[model samples]
Target: MTDIPRNPLIDQDVWTGRLFGGAEGSWYTAGETRDVTEPATGERLTNIGLARAADVARAAKAAAAAQPAWAALPPRDRAAIMRRAAAALERNLEHTAHYVARETGGIPAKAQLEVAEAATQLHIAAGLPLQPQGLVLPSTVGRTSYARRVPHGVVGVISPFNFPLILSMRSVAPALALGNAVVLKPDPQTPVSGGFLIARAFEEAGLPPGVLQVVPGDADAGAAVVEAPEVRMIAFTGSTAAGRKVGELAGRLLKKVSLELGGKNTLIVLDDADLDLAASNAAFGAFFHQGQICMATGRIVAHRKIAAELTRRLVEKATTLPIGDPASGTVAIGPLINARQLQNVDSIVRASVQAGAVLEAGGTYERLFYKPTVLSNVRPGMRAFDEEIFGPVAVVTPFDSDDEAVELANRTEYGLSCAVIGTSLNRATAIGDRLKCGLLHINGQTVADECVNPFGGRGDSGNGGSMGGPADAEEYTQWQWVTVKGAAERTPF
Candidate 1:
């Protein structure tokens, strides 16, 4: 690899590796490599080695072979390693946060939050070893039985670009803690930042090789990892369309799959709710990370009495957000990942305008920086109202009552997350329950929090994977029931 910058983070002599067992601290480099560019400016950030299909297969094979040894280790021992890794991450908090911000265009404060969250997830996963709970099936049909959770052998993780480090950690930590070997396929855009940091920490903590492997490449490389027979389970987090493709391949291989896909999440505001707080939080949730999050509040449904007031407050808040370089502490907004995402956001906003939505503020696009935009009077047939824009754009619509608001919220096919704002706790809780989403927030905006429980979406948003609690550890595993009926009693028929 050629050196473009003298930054300490960039590794010269570009090398990739199969981070599975028996190959402790081994470097595997493909002859081909490419340059990674920063979104804000077209400067070269780093040079990354692109792993091919063959490299993916080899990584999977290594993980598969290492599974038995990893699973055989005592749960406490495994937990100790994970806890050490978390400690290591905590020590290097500054560098980790800075690297994520520089590469992913995330602001310093937000990036710092994600780094801490990643560490907390590791800490939570560390607790999994001591909390293995199983159900007793006392004498079912003349046989005493019980159900136990077991590792699913070699599992594959396909992560997304937005919130790369935290989201990947959310999946990887639990899988590894549950005693399963993991082959992590990081998003190509922000690959070096997340996986590289994790690998370094794991090595420093003396984690067993092959327990966690990271391969950085494009879709072809990801597909190779998913299609491998050695990979028994696939945990994917990305767009709904891409999730479908990965699901299809996993289905052909009869592999277990967990998907957390796209969403057009809604922030419902009632007439009697706190308009100022809701507007401020809604602005942050809708535009944070350039509105690329799966659970971002892309659609805002407001009660008619307060719709105009909330819209006015939201537009005012969006206008004042300081947009600048991601590294600057004062800058709250950052550039989009690349040109494609910027253009996609632009196209969707244009369509929303054509469908009767009125622009509230900020529609200028200069390079990767698309101004934080808000639209009013958005109707059903527009792409912005229903589709995952994946950019800094929000579509606002008004509803008559709670029933009509719930109906409008569920109008889209995606069901990842939603938020309700109201003065009455009982009414808000009741509305939250009726809303069709994996996670519902009352009087507060949604965020990917480690302490809070995580649930995957239904419908096109994808389903069946969680990252926080004891149940998260169970999801990464399979089950095996063994019955020892007094050594079979040598029963002869």
Candidate 2:
């Protein structure tokens, strides 16, 4: 294994303290500290400060105190600050990417892409205030009415480890742009890249103190933020099980919440599709980021006429991809986030193969690294076909017709993402429409995401809320109706 180059620009300070309102330098010493390890090598990276309930309370109070003034600021002025933050992120992109690679086991190239995506999201969010606002309604005689959008007081943002930078900013950027204060809780696994890097960006950008707070900890810190009465809303991105718990707790408290949960996404290839294109898309979608993405291509449904050819091409593509240490800078597949993830993926692959699914390509693991794997003859009852195997694994199932393909794709409880590849655009579009999912692609894989698009899912995936574009402002803010009496003279009681 080649030694990973550590960017000297990043130091221990980047992993040290939790941010409080206006006090960017304040370090929280009241909680227990935990060691963060590199998933690629199991080496101790750094010890991170964990925020407990008391720390959550302090951050919430500070956020609540600062929200009103931030909301009162003119929209353009607030946008200017966000733009400055975007610049700061760009300036520190290399350091942030290094942290992402070191902590999450992402290859340096992909890590850089994540950081660039975050910067783009910040820039996109900076324009939120300039977009159209609430509507003016027709009122009854002698009265005029209009509705105005306003921010939630304080929003709690809980993000997962995979794609930490992009996921965290998906909520944080919109909340801040909509004039809401944020109490962000990043996953313990990637605290420095997910939380601290974000805090430093805003701090350098000169955002007003107390508008943003980052608390890095485990479930205790996450629960603290959710239980904080001062937090009016919660925007969360993680596993469906965790999201359900968050939704249940927030629902009981009557606090607004948006959850971007899991997915057992599918990719369909029709009889008339280009086999090579389909194979390429499937390989990239299933293996990129080691298949840690929520929208990774978990299932592939191919028409019987082309199923065999597609499987052959997929195997050829999957086996050729380089796999090794992420720090090597030459490998395509990196390590899983931890040993548990590695074990879980291995178990599923073994069980699926034992249950009649044929292992076509790579299915072996060396410590945290799992090779890109492909399974064929996968049936509905097989675990690989039904479950979300969040690893570099792709399962292929044969379908007789388009109707059967749609049925197979929609059979899962998760309706997060899907893709249809066919020679005829109209047929592909029709097939895509029938797949019950939030995000769909006509000729590509289920992996593309844009800051300007509504990024979320349906069914067990989420609760009918989105996390990007102008719609996000609506999710993080509320509406108020105002009326003015045109000809009021006197009141009679």
lDDT scores of the candidates, listed in order: 0.80, 0.86
TM-score of each: 0.94, 0.95
Off by over 4 Å in 2: 1-9, 17-26, 485-492
How much RMSD separates candidate 2 from the native structure? Answer: 2.3
Q: Lowest-lDDT window of 10 residues in candidate 1? A: 1-10
lDDT of 1 by residue, 3-102 (tens): 2333333344433332222245345565466676777667877766667787788888888877899989998998898888888778777777876787
Reference-based lDDT, residue 100, model 2:
82
lDDT by residue (tens digit), candidate 2, 1-493? 2233344335565545433443343444545688788988888887777788888888999889889998898899889888987888787787668778878899989899988888899899899887877888998877889998888899999999999989999889889988999999999899877887777778777778888988887788888899999999999999999999999999999999898998999999999998989999989889999999999999999999999999999899888998876776788988999888888899999999999999999899898889999999999988999888889998999999889999999999998999999999999999888989999999999998988998889988998788898578789889989898857768796
Number of residue pairs clashing in candidate 2, backbone atoms closer than 3 angstroms, sequence gap of 3 or more or interchain: 3
Query: What TM-score, to 2 decimals, does candidate 1 have?
Result: 0.94
Pick the lDDT winner.
Answer: 2
* Candidate 1 residue runs with Cα over 4 Å from true position: 1-22, 140-144, 490-493
- Alpha carbon lDDT of residue 309, candidate 1? 88
The residue pairs found clashing in candidate 1 are: 20-209, 20-210, 21-209, 21-210
